[model samples]
Target: MSRHRRQRGGPTFARAATLLQITKLVEFPAVFLSSIVQANVLPSRQYGQLVVDLSIAFIAATVMSLGVEESLQRALAANPRDRAIWTEALASRAFVGLALTLLAGILLVCDQTSLAIVGCIVVANSIYDLVVAQTASLLRPAVPSIFNIAAVIAASSATLLVRPSSSISCLTITLIFSSLRTAGCVLLSCRLLKPVRLSFRDAVRMPNLADRGWRPLVDLTVYRLTNNILNRQGDLIIAGIVAVDKTSVGTYALAFSLTTAANTVFLTGIGSMTLTRFSATYAESGKFELGKSWQRMTYLTAFLSSWPLAILIAIGPGLSVILFHGKYPGLALYLVLIGVVAWLGRISGGGANIAVLFTLRNEKLVRKVFLMAAAMNVATDFVLMPLIGMYGAIVGTMIGTFFSSRFLNVQIRRRTRSSVEWSPLLLLSCLTAIVTAPVALLHRSFTLSICAVVVSLCLWATFSWRSSICPPEISSRVHDVFGKKSSVGTD
Candidate 1:
């Protein structure tokens, strides 16, 4: 029976992951192109301010969320037809949005239009996040992914048409598109599930609506808040506080943006799918199946992430020069440092660990790990930023990522009592480092960089195919694509 269940679950999970990846592939280029346009059109200082505002808005949205989105996702995964949970979560988000709108109005009345704009953005982002979470929990991420892609393309086209010259103008355009995105998501979700009438009363009654108990919800909220702050906006916030000028902040922001783009394109989809699938697996089959799922996702994420890191290392310098007109100094080094941090986190199985822990309902441990890492990240930034400037932020993030990821892996191993097969991850990491090192040295040579990327990817593919580093299903699929037979066995 267990084997039968595994066989049934594997294909469903793979199809979902594949759909999400296709969505990201469509969305990433639009987002990357938009960043390039903004960087070229806006002055460095203005772009820096723009980055600061967006960061603040996102951080604020996470705070306002109160972790309800994630809590709802977990709940829905276990009980997908739970209408009460869905209604309460929607009401909570609506209430938060209303409060932010009121705050925006007050800010505008006080003549703080810049802050007002940010307040509005916070509302839009928060609502969008909740709606997307709702769809993802229902195991239908493609719906929101499609709308999100549309939003990005529309916003980018509008930006190109208007060609905003200042931070405020750019932000205003962003707010407009962001609101539209939120509306589209909400509309789509309504079609999928019954639309609940939201009121301030439901918001006031949210505490009492914790049908599963409040402690878990609160713990999840806290964990998510800290994790979001550390991962999303920590460096920029610290850089803004410690840097001498906005240009430095903007430079770091641009570098981080490129790394983030890579992450969004390659990892975000799989990570989301992993959480939902892991939650379902845990509910149905317990930790044994959960451990198997984690190993598969870890290997898959590492393999997919390696391609972007290789490309970035090989051609990032020339790409930066062409895209940003060589305006941002030290861009290449920042890319490599931040990119390594992301790659390290993946190979360390950080994302899979978090998903597994969440599925196991170990929120308190996750919260503690994230809080400690957040503190370390902030402390490192404060101590090093004044002395070393932007590099301090990069180093701080690297330290925080390393510690949190390693700690989480240890906890996961203890709880599951399942040993991780690290050979594949180690092999991939070593090969990636070796092949990309020469390209990094010759990053200035565009021809060599291009050739190196092709060579590196071919090597990765050949080695992975021969050694069966990829998950068995993936390997077999590749075999089918090439009209060959796979000798790989199922887990």
Candidate 2:
């Protein structure tokens, strides 16, 4: 029998992408509200502490999860009914959680209460993520996605209503909501699938390195660790550790959170779907079809992301003042810097890192690329942060992103012997940058900034529409949405 099932012809790329985008659209508001509430209500020092605490929690969670989540997903995808792998994975995660809980207790005894709270978050988030991985593997992601949305809404509502005085209180409320969501997910999963039983004996033992999944598990774990450190919370963590004042950390965290939110909303949706799509395409067809799909999706990602990037550049300073209720001196510069780097990184060589892992199945290569990037990022941050503060962290990240993207593109091309078609994406990016340039001058006047943003978007849209810069698949979908027949033809 084949190790993997034959293609059952899942959702079309366009349909899958559209559904993912819709899902993010529904989720983004709650997430945005949560961020806004936290930023606006908390004092800068408290907010900085909160950011640091959460970053530490996330990093710890990533470490404890042991990258077995991806291994479990791959195993379950091949055989969804495999109870043995499922149980083993859960036991492994449980074992790590238990160990971490003990560490938390130790910290509590040492009077590091904030870190103790983070330790609790680490356990909760790790297990929750494992459950989510299982859901995705079983092709029932909506189960956990719904629960996640509800959890965010509940937590954010409580925060806004209660207006907690301390970061600890806010984090406690968040943990409560998160734990509830985890319980809900477990119950719902048990109902939908088989009940997951964790064996105490299994939980106490270390994983067998002799197992077939060991190599991939290690690779993925390192990849995720490096990626998280470099991209997700590394800046905040470094700033929290190295900055002279909590206010600077808070400012950087706020800017980081906003840009990350925008990224999650616009770019992440498509990237999330690419792994499955690329895997299936390579399985059923060949590298040729996979390359085509990659190009198409890359173009679409660039097109969708450009709008948010432009908007951020145009009105970022004004939006910062309005949302935070104060002038953040470098907030506008942070937005522009982070936004541009993020956009460029995603489109660089058509997001080759993701394609390499999911399509080429080269975990080692992915791990190496990210590790190199992380090292570069850390080195730069350490060198510059003491001299220039938060700006150093951002600049470090920018340099690392550029290097990693370029390195991945070159390595993937050499391995796959395929090239990304970048003409349309390049044109779109150039046009977006050109039109949004004037907004930098107008940023001081909120009214003028807004007006400039509107004008810039309109001009870009008109030009892109007329120039046919969008991928045919996306353009056709857009036309269909507007009840217009597509004039663009696919190859």
Best by TM-score: 1
lDDT of 2 by residue, 178-242 (tens): 55555655565445334556456654343433364577667777887887777646866776667
Q: What are the lDDT scores of the predictions, listed in order?
A: 0.68, 0.63
User: How many clashes show up per model?
Assistant: 0, 0
What CA root-mean-square deviation does each model show from the true structure? 4.1, 4.9
CA lDDT for candidate 2: 0.63
TM-score of 1: 0.84
Candidate 2 residue spans exceeding 4 A from truth = 1-13, 33-59, 72-113, 116-146, 195-213, 349-352, 443-473, 482-491
Pairs of residues at least 3 apart in sequence or in different chains that clash in candidate 1: none
